[model samples]
Target: MIFSRITEVLTHVGVITLLILLAVTLVYYPEFRLVVFLTFIMVITLTVYISRRAARKPPKLFDVIADEVRRGSILFEVDDDEVSRLLEKDFTLYEEFRKQSYKALLESVIIVPIFLWYFIYFYLILPRFVITDLNLRLIAYIIGFVVPYILYLASELVFRVKTLTYVLRGYEVYDRGIVSSSQYIVIKFPLSKDYLVREYSNRKCVELSRKHGRYTVRFLLYTKNTPKLTETLSNYGKAEVISS
Candidate 1:
């Protein structure tokens, strides 16, 4: 397992390293950069395909839940809509949480500088680097701008699709447990009385505590109907609301 994970990490790093190298090379050799641009597209397409395949693979937690379900141990199941709603709520809360973090500030610092560098290098320096006809240089400039933007849009699309797939999975609240998964489960745990239900960013979240671990599951954003879900969970176990 460790070896496979290492291999996957290396594969991703290698792809990124190659792309960076190609981008740098484009600065010096703008003539044949179109070919490099096409190669970049191909690489990105393959990466997205591989990522989607990996996403479909069942997580280890699913195996444990399958065994339990086979033994008729599951008591109740939550619909996919409820799971998705909760996940969306959590995503919003997480975004708000992230915005307040030092890491977010650091990311902005790093990303903004890199973007500025790319714009200056490609738009100004790259055109000057071109030792060819004005028309060809114009084409190079267009390719330089379009390729990166296309890559960025494609990457965002992949991320959104992956997140959507994850949250759309049906969840099961077993006789004594719950499994979090859409297609492949990643978490399964027994319910604990020490759990807390709280509101954060106008969303409901339940923090489940077990003998040796804790997991927090988020629910829908606060609305007129939010109390219904909270009331249902409260009926099953101890629940308390605290500040975000």
Candidate 2:
């Protein structure tokens, strides 16, 4: 009974609470710190086990959507295979975006801890430098921090550009939304929402607006991919042909 209650409590406690509990235990209950740490590990392991079990038991979101469409409960004209393909494409794009975002974030922050260590190391070793003057040692210390910081800034800019470029080209279209690709900008237009579509001679553009048109996003699709995408979106939206 006690273990079950503990499990229930820990399951309801959020990540912040868990962190706070660990910190408090480390500071105030040194004798029981090892036990508390083991408990935390067990909680994480249980959570992972539960998550994997749930994942394995699913009719999955895509499968449900496809089933609903097949039964004519959802009025989409797409077949189950098309629905599956589109959902898979969206999932793949989302996963790619998620991974690239994690990489960019990791790259941006990895330098921080390393340079923090450098700052401390340089400050501690100030006296051992050949320049014995206090002023020179101070300058050296500041330089050590400033140079790495500048390099970090440059790396952050580069990663930001790379991430942006990756999203701005190779645009993708599906039943729910369009995925823009390339180097500068990425836009997603959901067909379920109110949107505007404009077609040019060689390309097509999708515009989605929200908050009474207070915010808008537009993306272009090349001519080659327009037909299938237009067919998919026709039931939800219409396109306007633009004169040259």
Candidate 3:
């Protein structure tokens, strides 16, 4: 009993000491990191509080994935009204939206810090280094711009699960399956159509794949004509389950 109490007291003391040190650092240097740290804590606290406040949230996942896949997987076409109906026809829409929101949160959490780091290095510290090192200025600027670009790309690539292209205009999801997935990549789109295209930007046929473990999704963006859209595939997602 005495040992347990001592251990508990020590743990509390250690945590308090660490927090005090962190507060001191923040007070000394009110930098981006400190602000980001505080922001992250607020977000985490909000997420936990909101999640805990609600109970019996219902089975909303399967419905969403199913509806989105079905709506977006069609090869033919759909009108705006029909699309609305499809989206609202079932409970899946709500769940799919939740899924999207979750994806957004994951992205936001990741991006906030990377952006802070960029601000610190480029806007804050890099100038000091470059002022003394004439040879390093060009490289520094290049690296500064490129590093953030890379981080932005990486964050998007990592968290782009809902990155779907409005291919086939109004076509719907006939089927879906896991073509492939990974940390930096994920491809998921309608399996019914052979090709999905985004015409507004350019003409390209992009194969879609959901990201691994629900982090992000990736679709191969390419261009092709309607005649080539005849090809088809079986089984969109692995172990395809019927959702609400």
Candidate 4:
């Protein structure tokens, strides 16, 4: 905990120092304003990418690995129907995991081409104001807009789809708690009073929650052997089971 706090503090200090340097350069060196701005945006984007990647990295082997060696007894694998029921029951909680609706599909279809056109229009006009030579202006436009747009697209494709798939398809159950996947990470929740459990009417399914910082992480697990699953959880973690 102390190490984590120190690292967080250092991260903040570094970012603040970088910003101050950028500000100083922009104010004192007008000739390099464009370069400074580009550097600023690149740094910001790279920081975001690194932070997100770190957040999505998996935990320790014991917590996240799917190995046969010391795999602790397999409790259950969450199935499609179970996932569907959970989504149907508490969609607001897991809306991002749901399949894309027609409205969203339509919006994407409409917005992407329009965004491209907008970028193209600006790319054509903005450079003329700054650069006198046609070739140099085109090169500047490529550097400023085209590269960033491609990077944006690549990041979206790499991160978002994997995250969506993990949320929708990856869940595992063990004796103590549940293990679920997110983006490129696997999270383990230990069963305890601290974790909330909701049992549906038939005892075939359960929803569990753990508080992580300010956010609540929840998982739904289903099993054919409902009694055994409940008993195992109760015995291992003494979880308070709430009926829903």
Can you write out model 1's per-residue Cα lDDT over 72-98, one digit (the tens) per residue? Answer: 355455676665666665666467455
Q: Is candidate 2 or candidate 4 better by TM-score?
A: 4
What is the per-residue lDDT of model 4 for residues 1-244, given as tens digits with 9 covering 90 to 100?
3565477557645755675566555445659878976786677567555654544453232345534212566565666666666545554444554443433344234335534653464456563576556556545544444444445444444433222122334456665345554423343434445677777646355666665432355555655455665665676557777777
Error of 3 at 131 (Å): 5.4
lDDT of 2 at 202: 40
Worst 10 residues of 1 by lDDT: 207-216
Cα-based TM-score, every candidate: 0.38, 0.33, 0.29, 0.48
Q: Residues 1-244, candidate 2: write the lDDT tens digits.
A: 3554465445545543564555455445659857865775566446444633432232211112222222322222223343334434445346866886786566646554744655365446644657655455445544553455345435544553222212223444443443332322222223333445544434232223222211233333433344555554564344333322
Local distance difference test, each candidate: 0.49, 0.43, 0.41, 0.52
lDDT by residue (tens digit), candidate 3, 112-192: 675577569756896565254434554554454345535554565555553432222233324442211121222244332
Q: Which segments of model 4 are wrong by more than 4 Å? A: 58-96, 99-193, 212-219, 224-228, 235-237
For candidate 4, the 10 contiguous residues with the lowest summed lDDT are 159-168
Return the TM-score for candidate 3, rounded to 2 decimals: 0.29
Clashes of each: 1, 7, 27, 0
Once superposed on the true structure, which residue ranges of model 1 sit more than 4 Å away at CA? 1-5, 20-31, 48-60, 65-124, 129-244
lDDT of 2: 0.43
- Rank by TM-score (best first): 4, 1, 2, 3
Q: Kindly report which residue pairs in candidate 4 clash with one another.
A: none
